[model samples]
Target: MTHHAYADRRSGSRTHADGRPPAPPPLPVAARRGPAGRRLLTGLFLVGLVASVLPWWLDTPAGSLTDATATTTAAGQITGLLAGYLLLVQVLMMSRLPVLERVVGGERIAAWHRDLGVTLLVAVLAHTAFILVGYGGLTGRSPWDQAGVMLREYQDLVSAFAAAGLLVLVGLTSVRAVRRALPYELWHATHLAGYAVLLLGFAHQFSNGTQLFRPGPVRTGWIVCYGLVVAALVWGRLVGPLTVNLRHRLRVADVVAESPDTVSIYLTGVRLDRLALLGGQFFRWRFLTRGCWWQSHPFSVSAAANGRWLRLTVKVVGAYTGDLRDLEPGVRVWAVGPSGTFTAAHRVRDRALLIAGGSGITPLRAMLEELPPGAALIYRARTPADVLLHRELDWLAQARGVRIWYVVGSRNDPGPRQVMSPDGLRRLVPDVARRDVYLCGPPGLVEQSRRLLRRIGVPRRQIHVGTFEL
Candidate 1:
């Protein structure tokens, strides 16, 4: 096998012909979240709330109605409006727009996406039930009969029912228990059905919704909202990766085993510095190799990108990742970007507290190299063998004068857990509460750490969490 010179080292800086480190990449514009973004989001929420009541306000009969039928119809209309708005919001979140991701961290966006998804599902159900009830009462028929009549009588209602059914299936699979049981590929494919679900909803609304039947600002607003969301989704999720891959011409240069189950895949590309990837951010990587090309997986940069090479350390937790161990050099790579907000740029406090567990060390390890002085790291692993990239981590600690604390032991051994506890943490880092803490680990550990940090007086905004698990 031919060796690649660029893959041999992991450093952030690149030397030019004159022997100086090349100029650093320009900082991303969205790095700072100011008043404008907050105000925009607030305005969106307020506008939706106002729109939910617009239909009733505009209809003269609705204002003077004093009957149960009118009340049911009004309830149905309001729920439908709110449901449509929420569904659109969820689509925007799914778009993976960089500006939004930077302003709101990837984790927060993901959390909101999940919450909004469930809420939208609930809203959709409420809209359907109420509408059926209202129509049934108006026509003097049972809701069941009305549902069948609506489905048969209206083309839009047929598509709406289909969309709702798909939404229900998607929601069921999204349940933690159900999602965990499904294979990643299967879950991903099922999730993509959400796009169709959203489109079907659009069709249903524009065709049947009373508020949007007539051409006006309300209809125009709905169309423009959906158009923008669809464009963002197409650009950010689809077109963006294709453009990046074509421009960078990335290919696997080498694969180095870090542990029995973990390997670092090195990629080389042209003018890679232009990717603007900070340490601690990750990309959804798709290796165009037989058996693994179909599924893309998220992995953090194990080191800073230096234009010559990019690195991602992944563990063999499943079949797809396990195959990565055998991935040969020269395989083309497709990537979807330098995402996540867990970086040195977000650090506000003078001192920094970096925490990692298992493979979670990938991003935090990169962060250690980029973070300034006064930063400390707490690495937790089942054993010394499980601690990845110790050689580089130790070198960074000694060279930079940063403190490294390794909490090594299995769960069966009390040492690791004890060290992570509030008392133990306080003992390890005396001024922990005053520091800006960056944590990357399992959900359970991260949650526990956040709780401990909160109890120990660390402000919520001062603690940032990054998860490797997508």
Candidate 2:
């Protein structure tokens, strides 16, 4: 391979659909939910209660239902609260991310964020199930048996069907493998339907809920909270986009062939502080005229807080990354994010594990520079030639308390030492379970290390694996 191509030691990649490789995968999930999750949950529960109870308190007669007695009314109210609880939890986990990002570093925050996402998905699914059952019981029809009244042109029934469709879409993306199968560009567009889903959920709660007749102090409180959260989401989606388009601007400064397939770009952007970015968070960087901005490529800041300079390490893999090695510096770029919550500084327990595969080492390098003490680093690359900045890494390890374990995949003429597999990890560190493990590598290697750690008794929480595609 040419030195330029060989210089960029990105990950192994297959030829993309368009006959070029894309950007290699990025660091895994971010750490979300510290004090933020709890607060949002509390706020949402209140709002849901009020949304449900207001109609009842307002002295409005119960709508066209035969069983409008206090028991049924109470049941509906309980259903709304439970359903609202789920919504609140989901929003809490996704929103107010600034606070959560502070608690944990950016990369693993994203992974945990996705994991918690599954939690929210389950909540929505269960809430939907409960609503269907409750409404069906009232109508004397099975929840799944929607043939009769749904055809009657009732506004409420029509709303129910719409809500059902949206729920189905959300549920479809909940599965892990299915999610990976979908094109990310399409997935994001589909994900935005969440706003519509929220709207439908609120409308359903408002028009059909028995609690709206409630003339209570608590009902008023719920109304205020629900309105606030919805308003915030609208601002986030709408205003957030406008701001990205205008305020936080990025311009590509340089593209260097660090390894054959792997390249690095330096970004000079305005409003770094305004971005409210934590170190390990990533962005959906689109070179606009070149790469897929609409598609949103997620790349972590290899080294951020450069005041105005942000570095992104890339490895060619597909449509987005194919031409990265050829790009010149100083090109204007538009990117969105600072998303995901994966990083250190949150784990009060000092000891840690930092695993890096090729360019995935970028974010962890920044993390180590920021807080180098009390951590063990496992840097793995295909061959010894692939290890970039080895001397610098070694110097840092000696200065700071970072223990280094370099696993060169190809080590011929070995002196009775091996560094390629999980067995190498076991030999290098006997106490893997006791420390907080931080891994940043290809999915395959990360998964292998994770399984080994688990088998050896590392708790899931302690094994901070970076798996977010960004």
Candidate 3:
């Protein structure tokens, strides 16, 4: 459908029954209420910031839920909801990243995304309150009696434990100060703990939840959903990597370092195409015979899908990718994907706003060739040197109806940050509010562009960004 028709169909969609516009229906819980949400707590935080400034919710006093037992019950429900929802959100975010890039417009889904995140957060907090109330019956002397009561009856002990574990895992990651101070490798390992917490939560629900444990279809349905989520995470996060390692893979191809620490690797192995990848997808390639599986990292494909050879342009970021420039042409490398589905195909908007920062420019370079006409690009790089695909981008810009903006930040002795935040894109583009904006790159750039767009009155329905570059 045309943009106008599509928007009309999706809007409150008031039907004229004998010439009167009907009131909008209540928001559906199953559907995503917004186009998309921020990743994990990050999206929650951005929305939270937005929420704090507005009187969106009803008036509730500081101790509105002051009743001790009531408060505990409310907290328990909220916590339960949060843990389950976050797990689902993280999995969805990671899995959708690759394909989401292919689509042109994400803002259309913005409402659903925002609503899901908010609802889930509230559920978790409520879940926590409920659990607290349940446990309040236990004094120091009555701990065993509470335990006996829990054990004697088919209560949700397992789920409660799972809820506690999920909370702990989410809580630890929630602390930005702690997460940032830890090395990437360390943080990554610790984050995997969520998988275990989720598994326990699933078991707890089956054992405790009144709805989930019922006989026949009701129980089976929840079991299936819980199983699918855990299975997807295992396949995407851990098992996929292990399977690649077990296959005894070969590197097969290597790149001629275009610059220091940056080189392209042409990978060839058994059934590479069968790896099920799209043009802008990525992989966590592990080249071993040495270190650990914990070191494998994600890299985006700099080239489009050709079906014959899988290609990647990687710059040495730290430990794993740092040594990538020197990889032997014939060395053995375990490739764990054709993963992530971010491309421009998912867009309904013909005209687009494409933004990129630092290494983030690589994936966009691949997407640019595939982008339909009338697409605008704003690329941020430090000086002319750090601009990775200048030649390719410029060539695409030469295509009719394409606009390109290169923001160079540093003036003298340069660094990546010299061009990091391309605030200049805001001033240069006067009509930005009309287009759907897709951003990839540093967090600062993505965050800034979004804020700038909002300040200029672009509907929240038109701005989009992924949680991470990959």
The best candidate in terms of lDDT: 1
- Candidate 1 achieves a global lDDT of 0.80
Model 2 score (lDDT): 0.60
Across 32-61, the per-residue lDDT of candidate 1 in tens digits comes to 433366468768777876875676577546
**TM-score: model 2 vs. ground truth:** 0.72
Candidate 2 C-alpha lDDT tens digits along 1-470: 11222222222222212323323222322334344554564475567546554444455456534554434445545545555545544454445344343444344444555665555455555555565566677667786764355436456646655755775686677567877899776776776665566666665555555564354655566567677676665554456655775886778766655666677786667776566555555776667654544455678877545455677877788866886666666667766566654565434345677778877687776666555365688888877767765644665576566798877763343521354344666677766667777777788777877787787777787766555563
lDDT of 3 by residue, 1-470 (tens): 01110111112232222323333321211212233432444666455344332221222345657666555544554355345545565444443232332231123223344445345445655564456445654343244555565655644574555555565665565456886788876766766655555555566655654334456664564456566666665565567666755653546454545455466666666655455444445666676635533467667777555444556767777766766655666767776655543555434355568878777776666666566667788787665666775654555576435688777774243532333224444455656677767787788778877876787776776665643422
lDDT against the true structure, each candidate: 0.80, 0.60, 0.54
Best by TM-score: 1
Stretches of candidate 1 off by over 4 Å are 1-8, 11-43, 52-56, 60-62, 412-414
Model 2 bad stretches (over 4 Å): 1-77, 95-97, 104-147, 150-153, 213-219, 238-248, 270-278, 335-341, 373-375, 385-403, 410-435, 454-462
